[model samples]
Target: MGTTGGLADDRALLGRTSTAERVADILRTRIAEGYFPPGTRLSEENIGGALGVSRNTLREAFRLLTHERLLVHELNRGVFVRVLTVDDVVDLYRTRRLVECAVVHGLGGPPFALDGLAGAVAEGERHARDGDWKGVSTANIHFHSELVALAGSERTDELMRGVLAELRLAFHVVDDPRALHEPYLARNREILDALRAGERTKSEQLLADYLDDSRTQLVEAYARRVADDGETPH
Candidate 1:
């Protein structure tokens, strides 16, 4: 038997650096796409079948996600999606403020990539007018992502994506999604407008207020949910 297998080509065909990392990426996408909600138990058997990956590979991916704080493993039970607490929200927003505000201050010069910010703002408004709060939330994520991208730092963008994913879980706790997200659309636009006008100090202040309002909303929403969960019998 004579065969020259193109293992490297095969790897490229899989579209990943490794099977486990690929699986992890897919799972992350599922989380981002809202396919897996917070607190949902991720059955290895079901996920393995759906993804057509072996148990070992799936578990490896699970390990990666758990490390990323997107999933958590129970003592005896299996892995489940992480539900960010109010404290988690607080810490997450704290990180967001530090990073996002600094990025605004560190802007190199004019011709800033503020258009993405504007586009995200417009997207949110359009979604809100159409009464699609989830759409607005998605746009909000894009808005912040674009804000981080303004720094032109891949590491920062990667870090912020994970933070935003964690933040999304907190949003799931909101009772009125529309009410929670509606007020922020205009706020985002204002930030973009300030940046476009080259008002760094004003933009920075707007961003601080933006993060403060969001943190307060998420904290309150999470607190209410926690109280409700306490009342519900296990």
Candidate 2:
């Protein structure tokens, strides 16, 4: 992400928070949006100066993200975005399956808001129409964010935001973005359609299958990269 103007933009995104909190919020969003891709070093001077924060305050922010598993600290190489391993990928999907599938499974017995999920589906369709695969990828993040929101708990939403942020780290390594994201647009539609039609069982099954297929695809892609680098994929 551009080290400049992030604080102001992120303040708007975060509204009112402590200085260190604002810094972490901005950095977290930047990392999630693929602004700070995996392994990109965060320049303390550049970021601290750009945000007009003291080094100590900025360091505190960095520490927050590091704790979130979004940033990694090296002895002398400074802080960089965390590069997820295959084990990380598997765990991420496991979390997704537990959270999102539960939301789908719980749909029938109670009433909840579907606006977030529908809105994200529409956003994805809109972006896909314009051949904006990256835009679609961003929309896909929101789609899952919306799915988690269906659980109707702010705590779950908060937990999932971090989960998706880590998932994006895996997404960043895709050799072909369209190949990675395009095939899923219709699948999302099917899941949404099943939910809309009140087929809770079908919806849950679709999501479970979606999670399994996606996990496999991402693991294969990541493994290929690691193998190319002469390191065994985890």
Q: Which candidate is the best by TM-score?
A: 1
Q: What TM-score, to 2 decimals, does candidate 1 have? A: 0.89
Model 2 residue runs over 4 Å out of place are 1-17, 110-112, 229-234
lDDT of all the models against the reference? Answer: 0.86, 0.85
If scored against the real structure, what TM-score would every candidate get? 0.89, 0.88
Residue by residue across 111-150, what tens digits does model 1's lDDT show?
6777788889889999988999989989999999999999
Question: Per-residue CA lDDT of candidate 2, range 208-229, in tens?
Answer: 9998999999899987886686
After superposition, candidate 1 runs with Cα above 4 Å error: 1-17, 231-234
* Local lDDT at 128 for model 2: 86
Query: Model 2 — TM-score against the truth?
Result: 0.88
Total clashing pairs for each candidate: 0, 1
- The local lDDT score (0 to 100) that residue 230 gets in candidate 2 is 66
